[model samples]
Target: MSTVIAFIVIFGALVFFHELGHLIFAKRAGILCREFAIGFGPKIFSYKKDETVYTIRLLPIGGFVRMAGEDPEMVELKPGYRVGLLFDENDKVNKIILNHKDKYPDALIIEVEAADIEHRLFIKGYVDGDEEVLKNFSISPKAVMVENGVETQLAPYDRQFASKTVGQRTLAIFAGPMMNFLLAIVVFIIIALFQGMPSNAPILGQLTPDGAALEAGLKEGDVVYTIEGAEISSWADIVEIIQKNPGKDIEFLVDRGGNTLEIPVTPEVQEIEGRKIGLIGVYSPVEKSPLKAFVYGFKETYMWTKEIIAAVGKLITGQFTIDALAGPVGIYESTSIVAESGFWYLMRWAAVLSINLGIMNLLPIPALDGGRLMFFALEAVRGKPVDRNKEGLVHFIGFALLMLLMLVVTWNDIQRFFL
Candidate 1:
């Protein structure tokens, strides 16, 4: 696959899954998610529903879920949206007035004259306000079109994020990372059981009839211990060496009944699909049970999460350095290589990346999910939220520093991978 295509899919899926988590939790907690955008910067395409603007932006590396009153700078705490219009089964003008009286309890109803409102439906709210959503807002079938200017009112306070309890707010913040973790587990489950994972032992499950293995004196059920003096842990290691050295002499170390034997064999040079490749003529067994796959998938995600936490701990203790980090460029290059390997390989790598993203977001660093959770935890103890300006200043500084670090790491990755 083209590196660009690989980069887009990998980045898009990971980021979309992460943002979806926050959006779902926010809606559940009665917080208005104003926008759910994939990527950053200028939006290329967008659609609005339930007061949320879903969009795909220009950048492909990251995404965001914009909630009302969550970011004090971007959104108004009492921003109002025209959700639904009042309509009546009654046909006359008095019916419309009665409909407004019965349905629009909080809205300021206004009548406007229009040039073309015969049999057509249109509901106009605030068309001049800077933040008013005016396009595609009406859902009524029989409501007459209001072409003239109309006044709108503020939305209910209960619908804004700032009005929610601290616990609910914390859940919405944490949900983004939690969704990433769930994505990893689901991806792993499908790949591990259905696509089948590489056998750790790489034991030969069966031999071909008079094929390369039979001619080379290799028997079935042979446990491949090493190849070319390198200890073998999985079938992937064996395939890597074989594919690279087609028709070349291979030294295999196998354990048969506690006896170590060195077997020399030459892989068959096979020409297919305009490429010269090596064929070992043996198949490895695979795990195919759904229940077992689920169990192992969870275990794999847990282990990966633990590894990430350990890496972070090491970095904190000066045992690890910034050089170990992989920026966007590094991820793109790695994804390209994995994509070339096969579908299963890419799936496994994506799962690992998802788990890594989830774990990273949970770190108690400023401007991250865990950082907000830290403040929330403090609020729970102190019985009051921190000062908004102070918290915003800290996050602003942290975001700046993070962007700087990203630039440095991206430069390093460009030097290592591209240049």
Candidate 2:
């Protein structure tokens, strides 16, 4: 039950924020948004307001925004009307700009009153006398017609998407991922302010056999009062003292079971990631106050984000194994363990996971919000949108690869748990 609740809370918040991005940007772009729906498949419940239908679906996994003119088949156009045309769906009238074209057969006398701009559904008006007509369009009922013995149905909604200006459409695509990134930063800051942070303890908890602490005669439960004549309040202080005293003997004032004692110990040299630092084996006890908890929470959030990004980079560079990856089952089991630990631990983990979710969603992969933003950026740079069919195909390939990876990760999780 605890695991279920945690999953629901975490997934729900992450997904809601992601979709909320789309909803916000759609409204900002003055697009006719038909629906802002959370989750997928059949709607469980919904409400309509201000020309937008808000819905909760059965599956709590994903969401979408339905915008006007998003489909090409739906764009309606009238005959003999072409240049600088904008489709006004609300008005349902096509404005015609009459232009003459001299290239025509004498018998046909096809005066190009308006050129049917192939491959473009919408066009912008300029200062020139280039008149354009607006048309109504819809996408449905796929059928084929023969042009010069080649059968093709009107490529549905292909031209409609091409009509919008690069800047306007790029904003629509970028809004969602940008929102996720901002949410992560905000959550990290909040957690930093509220969560109990891990700090070093002044006293050594366990002295490993042959470790620096043991070699220095540091005993368990010995409260380190001073190092090198500097008063020690926390384990961090001890670390600072040792780090500065590498390969040097240090004087210590310790309180062991109410008895004060002074001892001299040589700091051991320890190499971490190719850098040598002084080491004294000790572990900090978890401590929390209301003020410290908040600060720790936010710090932990930021740290976790950095850790995940680093881990992903390592994985991509072959420094990490795919076996380290976790799927839904792994998360479920981990959440259960955290929930059982205690309230503060659970809260800390949740905050960390929230920040992780925010970062992961921002990765530029197809079938993800970030991936869509990449295409939008390209369109913005190239002065044109990508072919809708090609874009859809790329996303479809990404989705398939994601599914395969999920399956592998899920299998690994099951093996770790039940096996």
Candidate 3:
């Protein structure tokens, strides 16, 4: 379905850039990342590169960059940690296992009889546990083949998230959200350059038949100057005025066919979801310019970010409700609608959604980038890191609450949109 494709592309772009940001910064900070994943659930594809496994999963709702020491449950393997090596060939027996006997005295070396030098290699961590792995490596079998609550190997002390200074860890945590902003900026800039900046003058172009504009004696060639005494400079100005006043009468000063005339028009009030909004049938013309495009792109991104932050503030202060929020369902449905509006509109919506993702990740709740930064702030004040277990527990609780909230929001979206 077109909806499926649009949702995947939109969510994929935003999340990929976000995770990539963390991956780059983590590597730069000398932290070892085990996995760079683009989705959740069962992995559809995976491969090892350098020291990390890159994975693509079936779900598109989320993704993650798994850095060493970030998770408290993962423990670094000590030098004394032992493993069992099983191989089918005898020529490379000690060369692969007993050669390291000087380092690991208690390691088990099992020689299985098989034809040729094509040996099945396995380094079993906690052979007392079940997860026996068989691999076909030419030499080393030190891969983390563990099972039964095995203590896995984490990054070196210098490479762990906690081992690093507060500043380093803070940067890594904040990098994810910052990347989202960067993506929005890029998307906006490209769209502006390709499609051009929106017209500065408030000129009406498309007029819907039997709509509010037609009922008010307005024609397609009219250029609006002022609406309800507010100076209308562009299309944004028109929507801003209408949104603030639903079912309200407005005086429009327009230049129609070279004659200035005042036309009275009232916006039609409509109930969207749970909110009352106003709408008038009209469209604006887009103008192309290289210089103005860049400026407009930056300005638009800033404006969208500011508006999202304000909306979040309002939500926190009880000025807004959860009904006003769009969860996965609403987003998927909107993705379908936006996809139908052509490539430019789709890109524009992607930019807006990317900005929203960036803002949401900056919220100071547990299990989020902002939450980790909160811990960093406490460390700055205390001159040392907080108790690792306590911090982890707080994030666990926060994650649970967030999941519950998502369930509720998703249910609401389904009921509102699909049902």
Candidate of highest TM-score: 3
Top-lDDT structure, candidate number: 3
Write down the TM-score for model 2: 0.60
Ranking of candidates on TM-score, top first: 3, 1, 2
Record all residue pairs in model 1 with backbone atoms less than 3 Å apart, i.e. clashing. none
Which digits, one per residue and each the tens of the lDDT, describe model 3 over residues 1-419? 77788888889988999999889988888887888999999999998888788999998888999887666543222333443443335522222332344454544543322211112432223333433653232323223333342323334456666677888888888889998888877787788778766675688766788679788998886888899888888888887887677788888899988899999988888798999977777766667677777777778889999999999999999999998888889898888888888898999899999889888888889998889899899999999888989999999999999999999999999999878
In terms of lDDT, model 1 sits at 0.73
Task: Assess candidate 1 and give its TM-score to the true structure.
Answer: 0.67
Model 3 scores a TM of 0.70
Q: Quote the positional error of residue 149 for candidate 2 in Å.
A: 39
Give the TM-score of each candidate: 0.67, 0.60, 0.70
lDDT of 1 by residue, 1-419 (tens): 47677678877999999999999999999776778999898989998875678999998868889876655432111224333234344422211222324354543343332211222333344433433453323223223322222221122356667778998999999998999889998998898777765455577766778567778878776788988888888887777777777898888999877888889878888888888888778877565777878887888889899998999899889898888889998998898888888878888888899988888888887898988899899989999989989988888888898899999999999999878
Q: Model 2: per-residue lDDT, tens digit, 166-251? A: 66666666666556555655554454445424457787765768767787777877888998889999887887888877788898
CA lDDT of 60 in candidate 3? 83
Q: Candidate 3: minimum summed lDDT over ten consecutive residues — where?
A: 115-124
